[model samples]
Target chain A: MEQRRKERIDRGVKVRSDSIYALMSWRELSYLTVPRLLLIIGMLILPLVVTSMYWQRVISIVCIYALLALSFDFLAHYTGLVSLGGAFFIGVGGYLTAIFNTTFGLPPLVSIPLATVFGAIICTVLLLPCLPLRGVYFAIVTLMYPLVFARIIEAMDILGGTDGIMGIDSFSNRWIEQYLVIIVVLLLLFGLRRLVNLDLGLIFRAVKDNDQAVRASGMSITNYKALAVLIASGMGCLGGACIVHIYMWTGLSLFALDFSILPIAATVIGGAGTLVGPVLGCLILVPISELLREFGTLRIVFYSIILVGFIVFRSEGIMVYGQRKYHQFERWIKV
Target chain B: MNKEPILQVRDVTKAFGGILALNRVSFDLYEGDILGIIGPNGSGKTTLVNSITGFIKLTSGKVMFRGKDITGRPAHKIADMGITRTFQIMRPYYSMLAYKNLVIPLFSPRAKRTGGWRGGGKLGDRDTVSIDILEEIGFERDSYVPYKLASTLPTGYLKRLELARCLALKPEMILCDEVFSGLSMSEIASMIPLIERLQMSGITLIMIEHRLRELFKVANRVMVLNFGEKLIEGLPEEVIADARVKEAYFGSEEAKEVMDHA
Candidate 1:
C-alpha cells in the first residue's frame, strides 16, 4: 500500500533571504522588498488612478478606516485588549479638532495634531479604570463609550449639538487632504510593524498570552495594558481628526457605530496581526462599500454575503494566506 | 536532614463559597529535598500549590519563606522571591518559539537581579542565554526544536519547556503541578534524570504527581490528601503501607483484597 501527503516548505528565495546578510543577489532582495514596494507604490498612485472625484474621497475614507483597523488589530492581537471604542476615539478627536478650528480659531494643521494628542490622552484616562478588565468585559466598556458620548452631545446641544459643527475648514487643497492621510497611514503602519518586534512588543505579547505568567515574570500587567491602549487610541483619534476635516462637519455622526464596526470587519477580512493586513483590507473593503452604495439599502445584504463568504472560506485573512503562498511552496509526497 | 526548613506552611486554608477546597493544610519543606504530594483527583493538590504560590488568596493561613510571612502575596511577588510554579495543563506562550518562551522570563526583573541560571553576576545576551537554558533541559540547540513554536512542540517537550521557563527565573523552590501527566512511560523515564539533576543543583522541589511508582523513586517524603484533608505524611514506604491511604485510594473492599494478597 502507498500513502501520500502534502508538505509545505519555504521557497529557496524566502529561505536565503531570511537573514539580511544572505540578501546578496537582486532576486532575493526583490523577493523580500517587492511586496512592500507594491503596497507603497499602489497606495501612492491610488488618487491619480481613481480619476473620479467621488472615488478620490473614498480613498481618503479608506485611509481613515485603515487607521482605525490598525488600532483594533494592535489592541486585540498584541495586547489581548479587544477594544470596540473606535467610534469613541473618533468622536473625541473629531469634536476636539472641530472646537479647536472653529471656536479656538486654529488651523486644520495645528488642530489635528493637538486634537489627536489630547483626544488620545482623554481616551486613555477614561479607559484607565477598565485596563484591569480582560476579554468581553473590556470590550463591553469600550462599546458603551461612543453611545454615551453621542447621546450626551445630543442632549446638551453643545459642540454643534444635533445639527453638528458646520463651517469647519477643509484642507488647503484636495491633494494635501488626500496625501496627508495616506502618508500618515503608511508611517503608522510601518511604525507599528517595528514596534511589535521590539522588546516592549515582546512584553505586550507576553501580556496577551498569559497575564498571570507575565505577572509571575514580575512585570505589571496594568501598566502594559494602559500603554497599549494609549498607542491604539492615539491612532484611532488621528483617524477621527482627519475624517472631520475631510467632511467639513463634526456631529453625532462622528460617533456612529459604523466607525466602530467597519474597522473591525476590515481587520477580520485583512488579517488580525500583520499590521499591513488591515490597511489592505480597508483598500479592498472601503471601495466595495462605495460600489455597493448603488444598491441602496440592499447593499447590506450583499456586503454581509461577502463578509460571510470570507469568514467561511478564507478566515485566516487575505494577507496571511497570501504571505503563506509567497513564502512557502506545497507539493505532494508519497510515504 | 537537620537543615532548617526553607518554606513553612501553617494552617493554610482556602474556601470557595461553602466548599472548603483546602482545609487548614500545613507542611514544612526543607532547603534541598523533593517532597511528593499524592492524592486522588479533586483532593486539593492544585489548590495547595496555588495557595502557597499566591495564585489564589487564602481564606485563613500563613506561609513563611525563610522566616518571612508571605501569606496572600501576589503570584508575581512570590515568584520574584524564588517560588515559581508550573501549571497542571501546560500554559506555554503558544505563539512564541520555544527558546523565545525562555527569553521572556529571562527578561524578568528577578532574572536580571539573580543573573539567571548560572548567570555569574551578570545576565548576558538573553537570546543566547535562552537557547542555553533550553539546551540544558533537553531542547537540542543544534536542531529546530528550540526554534519551533511552543504550540508545535509535543507534550513531552512542552512539559520540559515549562520547567525550562521556571529555570530561566533561577527559582529557589519550584512547585510542579503534574508535570508527568500526559507524558509517555519513556518520556517519564527520561524526565526522572532531569528531576534528579535539578535537585542536584540545590533547588528544592515539591512535585504533585499521580504516577506513584515513578514518584516514590525520587521523593524522600510523601504526603497523601483525600477529600481536602491530609490522610498521612511520612516516608514513601510508610505512607504506601498505611491503611487509611490504601482505603482512600482503592476503597475498603479493594484495600482488603490487596492487603490480604500482600
Candidate 2:
C-alpha cells in the first residue's frame, strides 16, 4: 500500500526576504516588511480608528496589558525568568507615582517617568536575593511579593492604607493620555526586540539554555538575570504608572491578581517568546474581556473557556501559529 | 613527548551523604598525554572527572590546575581557566542548531582570549567559524546535518558535538566521558583520527570509557579504578595484563569472555 504525508517547507519569498540581500527585489522586501509595518501603522491609528470614547479607553487598557505581557515574554522566553510579579511591579509603580505626585506636587509627566525608574530599582533590589533560583522557586517568590505587599500596606497603613492615595493628576487631557501610552508601548516593544538581538541577549539566552555553561563561558549569570529583571520590571512599572493617572487614583487594587494572571494568559494566547505576540494577544483579549463584561461575574467563566480552548488546541499560541503560517507552506507528497 | 604536568589531583575525597565516591584519588596529567580511566559500572570514573573539573564540590582534597589550587571553583570558572568536560549522557543545547551549539563556547571569554579551534573562528564571524569547527570534527562540510537541530542529529554527530563543544573552548585539558560507548565499530574508528588530531594539536585529555579495546588503542597510559580507589596506573598493556584488574573490574568469567572476543 502507498502512503502520503504533508511536507512543509519555507516559502520562496520568506526564504529570500529573511536573508541580508532582501533589498534585491521589491516584492521580497515588502513580503518581509509589510506585516511589521502593518502592526506599527495599525497601533498608531487605533485610538483615532476606534471612534467610541468607551472603547478608546479600552484601547488604553489594552496597551497597558500589552506592556505587561511584553515584560512577561522578554523575561520568560529570553532570559528564562518566569515572573509572577506583574501585580507587584504595577503596585509598586502606581504607589510611587501616587507618592511623587501627591507628596512632591509633581505633574503626571514627571511623576510617571520617575515612578518607572525608581519602582524598577526597588523591584530589582528586592528580587536580587532570589536571583540564584530558577523555575518554580523564582515563580513562587515573585508571586509572593504582590500578596505580601498588599497585606503589609493594608495592615501597617503607611501609604494611605486600605483607602489608598487619591487625586493623582490625570494626563493634561485624554488625547495626550491615550497617545502617550500607545507610543511608549510601541517604542518599548521595538526597543526590546532590538536589545534581544544584541550580544547581551546572546548571554541571556545562553543562561536560559544552561546556567552552568554560561558561567563556564566566564560570565556572571546573576548580573544578566538582574539586568533582565530590571528591564521587565520597568516595562510593568510604566504600565502601572499609566494606570494610576488613567484612573486618577492609586490603591491596593493595583496589586490585584488580575494584573498578574491576565498578562500571562495574554502571553500564552499571543505566543510565549515572540515580543509582538503578547501585544497582539492583549489586543484580542482585552476587547473580548470588555465584551464579555455583559455577562457580569460570569465573564470569568467565559474567559476561562476561551483560554482553555487556546491552550488545549493550539498550545503554541496564536503568534507562533501565525508566524508559522506566514513563513512556511505545506503540501501533500506521495512516499 | 613528556612535558610539564598540567594538572594535579592530590588526596581528593568525595562523600555523597554516606557513600564514598572518590577515595583519596591522586593523579597528575602531564601536557600532551591521553589518560584513559577505566572501571566497571559505579566505580566512580565519571566522579573523578566531575571533581577535577569542579562540577561537584569536594568533601576533601586539592585540584591543582596549572600550579593553582582550584578546588571547588564553579564549573564555568574551571572552563574559563581552559578545563572543559563532555557529559556521559550528552548535554548539547538541544534547542540550538548543531553548529550554533558551538557558538556558546566559542563566545566564552577563555575561547576569546585564546583562539577557538584555530583557523580563525573568532567573535565577529562566529556562525561561520562554528561550522568550520563542526566540519573539522567529522560533521560533513556543507551538509544539512550541521545546520540541523542538535536534538535531531544521529548519535554519532551528537558524540562528535560533545567533543566539538569542548574544542570550542580550545581547552588545555578535556574530560571526555564515555564518548565511544554508544557508537558502532566504524563510527568509533572514524572518531579515533579526530581524537588523534586534537591531541596532536596540543590539547591534553582524560578519557573515561567502558569500551576498553578502543580506548587502549589511543591512551598513552591507563588508570584502573575499583570501587572508587585507584587499583593501578601504567601503560595500557600492563594495566590490561594485571590479574587484580581482571577480578575487580572484568570479573573472572567476564575477563575470559573479553578475551574470547579478542
Quote each prediction's TM-score.
0.90, 0.93
**Candidate 2, pairs of clashing residues:** A216-B76
Candidate 1 off by > 4 Å: A1-9, A48-53, A99-107, A129-137, A166-170, A329-335, B1-4, B235-243, B250-262
Docking class of 1: medium
Q: Report DockQ per prediction, comma-separated.
A: 0.51, 0.43
Residue B246 displacement in candidate 1 (angstroms): 3.6
Query: Model 1, range B1-262, lDDT digits (tens) per residue?
Result: 6777999989887899988988888899998899999888999999999999988999998999998999988888899899999989888889998888887888788999988887875898889999999889998889999999889999999999889888989989989999999999999999999999999999999999988888988998999988788888899889878988987885777666644543
- Candidate 2 ranges beyond 4 A from true positions: A1-9, A104-107, A197-199, A330-335, B1-4, B119-122, B256-262
Instruction: Give the proportion of true interface contacts each model preserves, from 0 to 1.
Output: 0.58, 0.45
* Cα-lDDT of candidate 1: 0.91
lDDT of model 1 at residue B158?
Answer: 93
> Given candidate 2, what's the lDDT at residue A280?
92
Error of 2 at B78 (Å): 1.2
CAPRI docking class of candidate 2:
acceptable
